[model samples]
Target chain A: MEALVALSIAVLTASGVWLLLRPRTFQVIIGLSLLSYAVNLFIFSMGRLRSNAAPLLEKGVQADPAALADPLPQALVLTAIVISFATTALFLVVLLAARGLSGTDHVDGGEGRQ
Target chain B: MSFLADHLIITPILLPLLAGAAMLLVNDRHYRLRAALGLVSTLALLVIAIMLVQLADVPAGDASLGRAYLLGNWPIPVAIVLVVDRLSALMLTLSAVLALCMQIYALARWHRAGLHFHSLVQFLLMGLNGAFLTGDLFNLFVFFEVLLAASYSLVLHGAGQQRVEAGLKYIAINLAASLLFLIGVSMIYGVTGTLNMADLAMRLPDIAAADRPLLEVGAAILAVAFLVKAAIWPLGLWLPNTYGAASAPVAAMFVIMSKVGIYAVLRVWMLVFGPHAGASAYFGGDWLLYAGLATVTVAAIAVLATQDSKQLAGHSLLVSSGTLLAAIGTGQAGVVGAALFYLISSSLGIGAFYLLIELTERNKTAGADILAVTWEAFGEADDVLPGEEEVGVAIPATMALLGISFILCALLIAGLPPVSGFIAKFALLTAAFNPEGLGATGEPISTTGWLLLAALLLSGLTALIALARAGMKIFWMPASTRVPRVRLIEMAPIGTLLILCMVLTVQAGPVLRYTQAAAEELFAPESYVESVFGAPRAGELPQEAEL
Candidate 1:
């Protein structure tokens, strides 16, 4: 399970970097979203990926660190996910506006064309 | 009054936030009301910030260490905390002053250029103030996003083709940086099992040898993310283009944004990896020094190359960041204090310069437009007639005021004498040269110290020449240029900032003493750790037991 998660993160990051290096704005946007997903998963895995374990503790019960999952990383990952979604939407709007203005999807606004 | 005093630290974040939301609900047509609310809120923030500064100055003892307000009254390390010390209070005051001045300037005309400008500015304030005050890493990330998001909207406020292109690049670059930040943060949390900065600091020393490498990797990645935001070389190439393309008031407010990155670097690096980090002490110090030097050199060249006033201001921002980074990399208490002073002066100077750019460019463009029309009406050959000899025209009062302000900004940026900039650079160089300033070990000054001094002096020279050249073109060489009709609202903000710089220069003694104390507090993080955790209550079984 650890190997699979690490492999998935590596693949997503590699693909994101490849796309981010592209000159097209749309590709960059997609790249950023992919990168953010990888990051979100990475943050989630910070808790060490416990299966069938609760993140919460019962009232008047002493917390067992070995049994329960760390809830902080989970909360952090959730916040990151929401933020990334909002930013992605904002990026898409910006990309569309850029496309309309420059009449091209190029990141440099077609400055290289001439 | 006690309740208000107890909760003073949170007001800087909450007031602007609630005001921004309320402003959003107001009808768009009633910009007047929105502007009034923003002004009043920012002014109140200024007062609160001042009070906070005073509160932080009063030493609350080794236990409390200057007021740590845990949100929801939860215990330390569990609830998010807002810690206000001398450093945070100083940052709050700086941001509040910048926001207030820029807010007033925006009301003049930029607010009308776009929808929700006032609200976005208010939101930006909330984000900036919160970032400065928050004690937890997660909250830092949240506040960073808040500021960046608001900045994205603010950058796109006065939409044009260039503005949109620049805004897109800015968004993309910042998003990538944010992703890296998350990865780095999670990696640190994974290794250390904590995200509260103080808690992380307390736990860093006890990290097992096997996990040390992982922690180093996380710190390195996190530093890269911060360096990118701070506009270090290579990663900062987008800054000039983006900041130059932003509208005047937005660009002015953004002066604080890069400083936010620097603040995080200083705070986190000093706390987590300072001399107290044992084997991990001064991690990534060498990289920061070299990258910072390169950033300074490149920014100086860019300053020399920039044709427009806005791009000049942007490159100046990079130069300021590089100087501070390099100074902090030196790890000298005195140098850090001097760098902090320089940071304040340069930020204010560049912000005022950004505001001045719009006024200067407006007249220049108006003059050029007239010239183009006249030349078109006649023939190109006739434009070169002997009767059309170009020479300096009579300057108006507004032009004179702008010229004075421009010179003051140039002097500050170039680190010329009789201003806070020169005093700051002097203090830094003095501290760098003095062996005693190299900490209690009295380590001899290395070649890096001399190299940094050279870079500092050379950058100042380059800035002087560049500003002289730009100033000649804009202020002196213009023949029969129309005087820009500067509004009092706009001019007053520029004057206010420049006067503040002057005040900093005049009151350099007390201010430097304050920054010195702040730097000492930063270097000795034990007080900070003790204050946050509150002496570790009996039967708590240690906070690290949760890990």
Candidate 2:
């Protein structure tokens, strides 16, 4: 399971980097989004490939104490995703505003014209 | 209600977060109201930090409260915990004080470039406070983003053409850095099975020997993200440009931002990597030291070449960061203390330069000189100053104050006597030559000793030759055009900040001792572990920083 997820993250991150090399700012934002998603999955998978049981323990239920997934990375990934989302939005708007003001999506927003 | 006191770790972060949300309701551009709200909020944060410090003094849990409060009492390694101790508390206080001063110093620009400056400023503080207080690495990243996003908008707040251009690169570089940051965090977690820093600290020691290389690789990658943010060495190519182009007050506030990275390096190296950090071949502490020294050298040369006052100050900040990182790499308490003290002095020093840039706009000589620094540093093809009339309408009081500020900052950066800069360098020099670390590490004493000495001598000479040369042109060269009247609103904050720096210089003794205490607190993981884990169980492993 960890291998499968890690492979997916590798693919996503690779594609994200390719997209980030694009000429325009908006595409870069998209690239950042893809990268963030890859990272979230990767961090979530850090619980060492646990399965066969949820983390929550139910009353009167008998289960392997060691089988439950480590819950800490989940919390970490969850917080990271939310924060990344907010920052992505913030960057997208800033990019749009810069484009509108300067009439360029190229970084250095005023590149070549100045 | 007393539980509120135990949960004090959250208050410093929560205070500004709550205030930022409330600031959207404030429609008017009244600087007084904004200043009052920010000041009150920051003062509260300062008080909370003091409380945390006092708590650190007390033995852990001989009382009713736990040092690290698990959110909702979910237990260690599961719930997010906010840990507070001497190091974090001191950093919180420093960031708060700097933010408060920057907010007040920004009043003139507030009305001039209004768009909820108060809200953004408060939110920036919230991020800074959160970054310092978070006991989890992922949460640290979260706060780092919060800090950057607010900073992004503020950089371009004045909406000038240069700001727009410079801010683009700033945003782009930071976005890339953040991607790198995410990758690093994921890699660390993937091997460690946890992201809580305290939990990771505990588990790291038990990782399989064969897997340790991956851990160090993950750590090195993470270290790069911080180095980027800290503007260390070649990674810092984006910094001077972005900072030089940013508005004065925003630039001043930004001086603290890189320090966050240095603090992170210290925190992670000590906690996560353990005391014998990078003892393995893969993660070399010596490399960090070499890189740090290189950064200092490059930045100093860059500053010498830079003619723009803002860029010069910006390069100086980069150099200051190098000093701190080098100290951390040195692994001596006294060196770290010097680095930490420099943090305070340089943060304030840069603020005065930013103000100088604003106040001296009308002085073509100074403005041209300021622009020169950027041109040289960026390797821009142009050396030609714009037409004489393009000089800003300079203010006289602003000019004198800024001139004094530049000299003082130069003196400080140079490690000249009677200034905090001298004290900062002194501490580092003492540490490098100290017999404890040199003998224990079995490292050559002469190399580190001579390096520190040469750096000290060169910095002094740089101040004498370059800064004095520039100061002569700006202050004594006589402005061809008179500056406008400096406003009381502007002068008040600048005076106050400068005055505070002077006080810090005078109180250098106590400050150095506090920094030592902070470093000791940083190094001793048992204090942190005990705070978070309650008591060590028999045969329980010592805590490790999350890989």
Which number leads on TM-score?
A: 1
**lDDT for each residue of candidate 1 in B1-547, tens digit (9 for 90 to 100):** 8778667778998999999999999998898999999999999999999998887786536437446887877678887888887888999999989999998887666777778888898899999999999889889989999999999999887677767878998999999999989988989999998889999998998999999999999888888888888999988988987888787888899999999989999999999998899889888887888888999999999888877667788898999999999988888788898889998999999999998877776555434642343223223222322233324343359888989999999999999999989998998898778747544545776787797899899999989998998788778876457777777888889999999999999999999988988888888888778778772232334345333
Q: What is the lDDT of residue B349 in candidate 1?
A: 92
Which stretch of 10 consecutive residues in model 1 chain B shows the poorest summed lDDT? Answer: B374-383
Q: Write one digit per residue (lDDT tens) for candidate 2, span B433-476.
A: 87375347465566866776676566556645667766776677
TM-score, predicted candidate 2 vs. hidden true structure: 0.87
Q: What is the DockQ of each candidate?
A: 0.71, 0.43
Q: Name the Cα RMSD for model 2.
A: 6.0
Candidate 2's C-alpha runs over 4 A off are A1-7, A48-59, A65-75, A110-114, B1-4, B29-32, B57-66, B276-283, B365-399, B437-444, B535-547
Question: How much is the lDDT of residue B59 in candidate 1?
Answer: 53
TM-scores for every candidate against the unseen true structure: 0.92, 0.87
TM-score of chain B of each: 0.91, 0.87
